[model samples]
Target: HGGLVAAGEMTRTYLWRILFRDQVPPETALLLDNNAEFTGTVRNSRTLWQQDFEQPAPGLCGTPALQGGCSLALDAAHPHSTEWVIPARPGQFKWVRASAKARADQMEWDMNRMTQYVIRFRRGNEIVKARTVRLQRALVDAGWPRELHFDVRPPKADFDNVSVTFLYYGTTANLLLDNARLEAFDD
Candidate 1:
């Protein structure tokens, strides 16, 4: 008779038992068979944390307006209407848009608020080569809630820091800003 030689192999078994009295069944035994109790936890662990891209209070010259108010208007002549500078890493982005509102006026104003403007980005002394973004909608359309969405792509290489700025050319009008956010999607 010939016998085979095993080099490196191991076998193990796990056994669990629960003891309950005759009056009641063990609670732990019942939990082992129930699958509904552990439904959504075992899938994914990634979460999203949103940060608002808003300027500080002192940045604007006039009184800081709230979202509840009618419109948000800053002295265009003033240097600092609202300035927001955020640090960004090199990555592909689906869209970059800012949301704002225009005040209701019966008179025929320039409707400058309705017209769109450009958004620029800079890095240090040199300006990053990119196209301008425009404001597309008025706030009163959807009950003073306006949002602008645009597609943008920053250079992947040779860029260290990013400086964002909003430029608009219009007459005096009330501009409302409820909320503004910059969203990026993973490739």
Candidate 2:
């Protein structure tokens, strides 16, 4: 099978599911937000996750959104967002690559809050794991958006949600996020 797409269906396909092929190596999108671009309408869209961050103190945008003149903005006081992607069936999977483009309005080596781009996994309200790309002052100072990716190995297969959010530990600073993606890889 080729050019096959499945969403929120509890579906699985490989070179073969009845007889697994390690060499063929199955790669499928358990959650699909390829560019993390928020370009959908209610008429036809993926309704599982927060498609756009226009609520909870409604903001400008989400995903690779500078193109749309918007991005998911996060500050220290408002540290995290929720439900970027929800897998159709999380228990059948082991590894996921979470990615996003991040840019900070301000970052300093010792700022009360230094922005960290994160792929957060959750079983419910509890955070199962956080994979982070710690931003350096110099990188932010360079004035170019950084795209980051990391593999998440959940301690268990029960993680119910995946979020690409910007988190700040301290008390000040802002981070802009775009291009959120959560993709599954078979192991």
Candidate 3:
């Protein structure tokens, strides 16, 4: 005669006891059961990180910012930089959009021009740099802030880190950076 060996609950209880070496606590098991309901579902795009540079001393070298005090100032002498480490998750995020607001009074010339901004995605030995967006000279005349944007499709699977850098590249322009954000979108 053949019959079912065990139910799902029975198997789960056996494994839990074996793993924890004790009976599952009621509160802990309830919390796990509740969380299991939301697994394998898609949520809204998450804000991986954001920085307004509101710190009293911002940037890697603690550079002083301008008045209003919510931005980082970078020049050929000091290039404000920051980084984020992504976790090792399988198929969690497919694309990333990075954005920031900036303005410059002057820039260093590298035959072409100074880079307004750069985004770097790095994991293991693979590294991808989003194309540099050139700063326009008119912003100085208009005295208005310019928005910088970059969309990066990670080159290889399992990208575990990203670096957002504002480079002066030998330019004399004093670049003002504010409202930097990294957003992840699911496909």
Candidate 4:
């Protein structure tokens, strides 16, 4: 009899808690989203243009970005085109290195003329430096992802902007770019 009564009391207490207990409202969870600016540091490096190509931001063009998100598929139609323009404070960065995993479907392609890409730095209206990697044609023809790294030391004075460009020279090629990074260094 005592065991039965204890069980009944426990069940009643559980039911009462379920019916009368207070919960934290859903509105409280939505408070942080209203703030416009982020207060913390998002990236560790002093990178100038580190584009994972996740979002369509202020400085990109000729990019019909990949369908599900991740990379930029540069439009073959836009030859000798500057894809991204990133602004920088004068003299903030000394050395710059641009790198990416690039691939192409065409076997016989000429990077020297047809598909030349350049990482150019500018100061106001003057071009400070332009760097391009001279990749071997056989390496690209293997149908494997090639790692391209182009480094440049811009003029120590000052620069207004830098451009990530593709000098297609009016030729079409099936190219894919991923994990593109334009990192800046003090040295």
The parts of candidate 1 lying over 4 Å away from their true place are 1-72, 92-118, 136-143
> Clash number for model 1?
3
lDDT of 1 by residue, 129-175 (tens): 45443232222233233444343345555544444444445534344
Write down the lDDT of every candidate, Cα atoms only: 0.35, 0.48, 0.50, 0.50
Scanning candidate 2 in windows of ten residues, the lowest lDDT window is 24-33
Predicted structure 2: lDDT:
0.48
Model 2, runs deviating above 4 Å: 1-65, 83-85, 88-91, 105-107, 136-141, 170-174
lDDT of 3: 0.50
Q: What RMSD does model 1 have?
A: 22.9
Deviation from native of the Cα of residue 84 in model 1, angstroms = 2.2
TM-score of each candidate structure, all chains considered together: 0.47, 0.52, 0.57, 0.55
- What are the per-residue Cα lDDT tens digits for candidate 3 across 34-126? 111122333467877778877624443323333355577654446545444554343657666666766656533342445445555667535
Estimate, for each residue in 1-99, the C-alpha lDDT of model 2 and write its tens digit: 133332342223321231343332122221121222221221221323333343435543444454355777665445666545565446544556655
